[model samples]
Target chain A: MERKNLVEMVNIHKWFSGVCALRGVDFSVGYGEVVGLVGDNGAGKSTLIKILSGVYPPDEGKIYFEGKECHFSSPREARMLGIETIYQEAAMVPKMSVMRNIFMGRELARFRVGPLAYLDIPRMEEESMKALERVDLRLRSPHAPVDELSGGQRQGVAIARAMYFKSKLVILDEPTNNLSVKESERVLEFIRELKKQGISSIFISHNLYHVYPVADRIVVLSHGEKIGDFRKEETSVEEITKLMVLP
Target chain B: MRHTLLFTLRRALLLREISSLIMLLVVILVFFALSPLFLSRENVGVVLEIIPELGIVALGVTMLMIAGEFDLSVGSLFAFCPIMISLFVSEGIHPILSIVLALLLSLLLGGLNGFVTLYFGIPSFITTLGTMLIWRGAVLLISGGWPPPFSSALPTAFLVGRMGIFRASILWFAGITVLLWFVLERTDFGNWMFATGGNQVAARAMGIDTGKVKLANFMLCSLLAGFAGVIQSFRLETTLPSMGGGLEMEAIAATVIGGTALSGGVGTVIGTVIGSFLIRIIDNGLVMARAPSYWFRVFIGIATILAVILNTFVRERARKMRC
Candidate 1:
């Protein structure tokens, strides 16, 4: 099967002051595929994602998005290019409503009636509702403050927000870190839906079991080096675990 | 049938009270209980007048606070703004142009605070704290140890003072507050301010540009401070170097006591009004009751503590209920 590459990293070198965080790492995520990124605590999952999400530019490396090399000074620049990131603890504002969170930085302004820049609240509510529905959750109120939602619900909202924005590449960092069993399943199911939309994703997790079922290709990183990349049908969870722990 | 009944009972809650609304009730009750003079026609007029200026200051500080930032220089800026406007007006500059320039200058001041904080990655609290001192020094320098000739330039009936039904100051405050409320509750940018302060990291991830939000908030805060200064100059018919002395601390206290978390992400314009009223009433009552004027500070401090405790307790109970 032929796979089209959506993202490619070449010799990505990142350092914290002088200490090396990522050293000469190379990897690629294919288009329309769920790619798993597994590693230990210091395996540089966050560093890699930050570089990709434009949180921190790599010290030295080439990042190509859809066959063209690029560098982003900030997350907003990255987002404009259809790349979105959802960190475990930092994805949605707790005080903002579900619809506001869905639109957040990106909102559709209504036809300017006069001096006021009116928000198309009805349109936002409609869009947010459909986005929530895609995750199989019916929202009681579009105006529900995110802080009121439980852990599972918050995660659901985060995923839905990312999807609603029509991102081509959605990066999930430890998506189910603090979630319950059911919530984890909900996340997995959403990843499948992303597949149906042909939106590529990079799912980072400490747990190999969680990633295997959702991921089509598992890319194992240990101590910031790409150890192995294996197809789901070709590799078992045991092999992925052994590769992670042994390194 | 019993389970359904219990479920319905559990689902009920005190309608989500805007923190200010709840505080306003407490303030009215306490003031009314303490003094009959509080409800007098003259005192009512005083209350109405005072609430607006504080409301204007609160609206801007509310913006800064809601963005998870602080501005301790508003009082100083407020003093400086009117002095600048008076100076410009005295030079025969058009009042409208002078107003625009004053507003722009306020924006520049705010932008400077924001640029330093975001670019250097400094906490806004520290940046504003430093800026407040600097602005206060500048205000003193401009006054040249002499009070501004505010009386000569300002209108006694229009800008400076009022008679029977209306005061220029009251109208000024009301206009600003209405504009602020419209900006805060009716616009998308207003929503962004809340979200930015609520979770800086999350706002950034969502491409909300938390830096820009903070800058805008700071600018708005200073603009309000400046606007109030003009009205105050008119009211006092003078601008002393110490005109808006400690107004920053007062505005911040009012905001916090009104239920805005000093740490940011939760606050309201209405809440600040209640907070301002609480502090102001306490000031008036303490004086009427023959209490030490110094007690106002202590009362403000205590109110801050109570507001935080109340907020935490309410959140905890709400969490437990969910469980």
Candidate 2:
């Protein structure tokens, strides 16, 4: 059967200094599919995401987005292509306001297209509000500093920013690690909501309970190799957990 | 929380600066009261001459502190720049060309200090301190033990703030301070500088090239120091190799005393001006009152510590409230 790839990483080999990290690995994610990527500890999950987000470069491999070969030198390049990644550590300025944080790195400029033109604060606020509206939280003020928000609210804001970029692909890495039960459910709900919008997602989590329900298909990796890919309805959690832990 | 806030505000308000300003006032009054000679036009004229040149250097240092960096060599540059100007002017070179040369050299030296610190990952204080000694030594090696004398040309002499209600040095200082005020309060670069100092990683992630901003700040600071040096040399009509000695401390003290937070990201040029004037008055008064000059420095050191403690209390409280 021929596979229609949305994002294809072909023979991706990665190394840090002299230590081998990921060796000749191939993976792909299709559009409008909620894919769960599961692996044991030190299974190079972060390394894979880092390479995808342009934090690290693959020593060997070509990443083809929509079948177009691309090389990213920096995180900014990845962001421009709407390939948004929210790491376990939220990449945001803690002191800046919600509006500024939402528009950080990319700002709406006001005035007559001059070098001295002012920042379009109004436009930024408008967009920030719209983004927050999608989250549907009681965050009444977008001007409040990020430090003032709760952990779940902060996570919501990060997800909102990724979604607002008109992202075709969203990568959430361990989004529920520190969250409360309700908060985790909220994030899972948001993931389901994204799937309904026809936006594809790569949901990474070691929590099988959280991973199994929302995932359309679960991709399991052992050491540095792809172990199996099973449709959600076809595989049991115990079988996947066994595959995850089995040598 | 209320108690903490009240405690913070009290400390911040009753800062060493409050007493420093009062001390400046008391010193002025005492000098005037003690001898009619102190209040005379000639004596008053001498005191006024001190404000502008010192003020400009302090202003630049204030900005550097706000940006969370320091240029210790500014003091050496201050003396060396004037000496260079004198060296050229006394040798029959046009005064304007010599002035330009002195400032250009100052800018170049400052840029070197800034670029080396930012690009090479060396701390600014270390880099500028090294530059400071080298520049001062160069001035000494060239001028022998003494300074060269400039021509008794009226224009060159007056350029140091020898004419008008104030010295040209004071006017230049005021102008620069105002310009810096406009830039800091009005420009995107100003906001970026604060963000840079507050958290460099976030600033870079936000696409602001924080390294370049800091590098430019260092150059700007050193240029001002050099400007002050040129003023001192030309105004005095003489070049002493040791002229810039201990000036860095005074500039730093003035900045801290004026309300510029040494911890960075919060300071004002206006406060620096107030601080510089306050510092100059203390020195002048100490001299006039026949007190030991050592007392001035000792008080400034104490004031420095006091100001920092107060600023810390205020910031901690603000952080708690905001966060």
DockQ of each: 0.69, 0.27
- Candidate 1 residue lDDT tens string, A1-247: 1235889988899989788889889878888989999999898888998899888899999999988888989888888898988887788888778998888777778865554467888898999999999877777889888887877787778778777878889998888888889878888888888888889999999899899998999988888778888999999998888888893
lDDT of 1 at B203: 79
Interface RMSD (Å) of model 1?
Answer: 1.6
TM-score of each: 0.87, 0.79
Report lDDT (CA) for all predictions. 0.78, 0.76
Error of 2 at A117 (Å): 5.4
Worst 10 residues of 2 chain B by lDDT: B14-23
lDDT of 2 by residue, A18-106 (tens): 88778777778888898898898778777887788787789998898877887999877877787878765445566557877776656
Q: Evaluate model 1: give its TM-score.
A: 0.87
Give DockQ: model 1: 0.69
